[model samples]
Target: METLKGKTAVVTGSSRSIGRGIAERLAARGALVAVHYATNATAAQDVVEAIGKAGGRAFAFGTELGHEGDAERFWAEFDVQRRAFSDDGDTGVDILVNNAAVALRDHFQDATVADFDRMVAVNIRAPFFIVQHALDRLRDGGRVINISSAVTRLGLPEVIAYGATKGALDSFSRILAKELGSRGITVNVVAPGYVDTDSNADWLRHDKDAWEETAAKSVFGRVGEPEDIGDAVAFLASDAGRWITGQHIDASGGTRM
Candidate 1:
């Protein structure tokens, strides 16, 4: 079950919520994890400490993946973290979980140029380059899991921009799977629907009746938890998923028709 033992993982935007959940899961499975945060060192450090307390190895890394120079900074920081922690260089990465993303509430007509640009930068640009940078470090039988959203298939109107970016990523992941399949590298997308994270839980409590009504639509009868998606991502990043590639699997409690 320790398919990820002695492996290295870089989980971006991992200081909180789903990213943090994914990082913790990977570490628990015996992988050394690099936790990347945009600006909150304290939160990232907290996550690192939590992982350590649970008998896992983890380190905090900072990067503003939404900006121009952030990508280079991310890799440079990662190299330092990896080398300092893995002196023998035998702990090179075999798993890359693209979990970092930005989301803003905006209607299509009201979304500004800056809004669109920023989302694209973090959601699309960052993952693209991060994967490129980590390619050399990834072993032949590596795994690349992109965190996508149900909005791509749901086509929610207010989330046009966000959904578009995820759609593009879905396309990118499929093509990448084809390109890297020969090298034993697998690329896949995991799309989750309406996960009950900190923010959503608060909002849902305020509208209990509405939330219940919405939950009734799904066969699962409840919103998703971070652990739900984390488990799915871990499965894909494991040897059990070696034959799966170039596919977008919905982890949505069967909500979409």
Candidate 2:
């Protein structure tokens, strides 16, 4: 049942939300998960504790992404923990999930330079360098999965800047898949539609009419859950998904159908 019995995984921005879901799902499959957080150390630790109670293995690491030298600091801390987790030589990352991102409600007309720059930093730039830095550590036959958004696929101009970054991420992932294929490393992207996360609680959970409207967007008659995306990632990170590199998987549960 433990498909990833001895594998190691690092999920960025995993202190909560979709990242938390991915970390938990990976741990469920017997991977030793490194729960990476930006600033919420307590939240990250809570995830670790919860995983422990569930009979899974995990640890917490903190580093603010999208800043100078963040990728270097991140992997250094990861190596330290990987050493403590086992005696074998650090094999780098078996699974790397880039799930951290900054989203602001800005349209093309409203998006400021600050908004564009911040989103680009965390959503695109951080993952760009993080993976660049991880290449050395990412073991052969490893998996690199990037979390994306439905905005890129849909004409959601409400978040022009945010959507642009995700589009770039899609391009970045596909190219990596091609390049890393020779080394047996798989790179892919997952684009999620309106999920039921804390981030959407206000409109999707509290507003009755808004909840109905969002649910109607999905043919499933319900909104996607964080676990839905997590399970999808788990499959792609598994041995069964090795042959599926450089692909964009729509995990939106038939959104806008």
Candidate 3:
């Protein structure tokens, strides 16, 4: 349970939903979490407050991760906070969850270069460079969990660009695991299917019949929650998953054929 004791984790896009769930889970298991958000300062602060209230250590951070030198700037601010608070002066992160992503749900023909570029920037480019910037700080035997989508396997319509980006992430997870295994660093992907987050709340509420139709595909007979994905991430980040790497675990309850 204390497998992550004395560790520091950074969860990107953690202001709400899946990212928030992952951050909470890591903090609950004894890791000091940095809740990173692109915007929404109040929401990010709320997350930090909630974690603190729950007897966990956490901090709120903000960054426009897709711009030049943004990663370094973000780290500098993060370091100041860590030095001001952490008992040990180590800003080194032991867990990196690349959960920040932007989804573009459009048919292939409807997808524009702008949409594709945005997807690449947030989901693919940012994660790759974030890992690069954190490599030296990521202690050996650390964990990196990439959040991917099951749409890549299911080939969901109207999500071509989003699916493509997730596929790139999944591939990145496999390749990075092989490259980092020698250093005892573990890299894996948690691919989730149709989680009921704020963005999807409208659909689940107004489109009840359609939601049920989609839910029937899963053996669980219901949609997943952010916590469902979070639990899987916590397991992979724990000693319980030391032997697991170079793989993509579909947290999708038998939704894909």
Candidate 4:
């Protein structure tokens, strides 16, 4: 069933990994997807082509986040692509997925001020302002899904800054849910634990023992996959998840449970 037949979705950092998975899944469900990327134009185009080959609609938009006027730049490019993609001249979006993020691995003492600021800019500030700038474009009864991390609950000293940013993101979702409730716009967070994406290939894929330890963290005895997180976001972006908002859905495979 094409539940999202006439809707439009915007997924940030969707060139590869989890964001790519989410964008593909949403497009598969018949949503006209705007695949947002930071720098990799080729990778972003690959995503758009893949979606088209799958009989889904998608377009790529590039705007580097974590810098001045990042949100504005993204929206400007998004407007252009959305207008071109929409057949009925409808520019309103039905789903907004804030999946773009930067992961910083550093213990508190080794974490530099610049590193902290960069993390904040990408993870927290970007999403905050993106939503702020998207209010007019987002239609009533829309969905806002923020991609968060399990480190917010699990004490991961190595990624303290990254975890802190997700913590703030969760708080942002809770508050935004209330503020947007009247418009029937549901806001929520999906926190994934130890997904095996390219970003973690160096440590998770290369070291067998290290991989086992990370896999053991989940009750399922396996590391999470990109589809695991993508499926969770797909549910929230659908009508079935209408009643679920102002909440955190842990797509962590029972990690730390």
Q: In what order do the candidates fall by TM-score, top score first?
A: 4, 2, 3, 1
Task: Give, for candidate 4, the lowest lDDT window spanning 10 residues.
Answer: 82-91
On lDDT, who's better, 3 or 4? 4
Inter-residue clash pairs, candidate 4: none
**Residue-level lDDT tens digits of model 3 in 63-141:** 8776777678778777887787766888999899999999978898799999898898889889988898888899999
Please write out the lDDT profile of model 4 over residues 1-257, one tens digit for every residue.
57788889999999999999999999888898999999999999999999999999999999999999999999999888877766566778899999999998999999999999999999999999999999998999999999999999998899999999999999999999999999999999999998888999998899999899999989999999988898899899999999999999999999989
Candidate 2 ranges with C-alpha deviation above 4 Å: 84-91
Instruction: Specify the poorest-scoring 10-residue window by lDDT in model 2.
Output: 82-91
Q: Give the winner by TM-score: 1 or 3.
A: 3
User: lDDT scores for all predictions?
Assistant: 0.86, 0.90, 0.89, 0.94
Model 2 lDDT tens row, 1-257: 58988889999999998999999999999999999998999999999999999999998888898788988988888778767767787646799999999988888888899889889999988998999998888899999999999988887878889999999999999998988899999999999998989888877899999888888888888888889999999999999998999999999888876
Per-residue lDDT tens digits of candidate 1, residues 68-106? 777678888888877776687553678888888888778
Candidate number with the higher TM-score (2 or 3): 2
Q: What is the C-alpha RMSD of each candidate to the true structure, in Å?
A: 1.6, 1.2, 1.3, 1.1
A best-first ranking of the candidates according to their lDDT comes to 4, 2, 3, 1
Q: Estimated TM-score per prediction?
A: 0.94, 0.97, 0.96, 0.97
Query: Using lDDT as the measure, which candidate wins?
Result: 4
> Which 10-residue window of candidate 3 scores lowest in summed lDDT?
65-74
Higher-ranked by TM-score: 1 or 4: 4
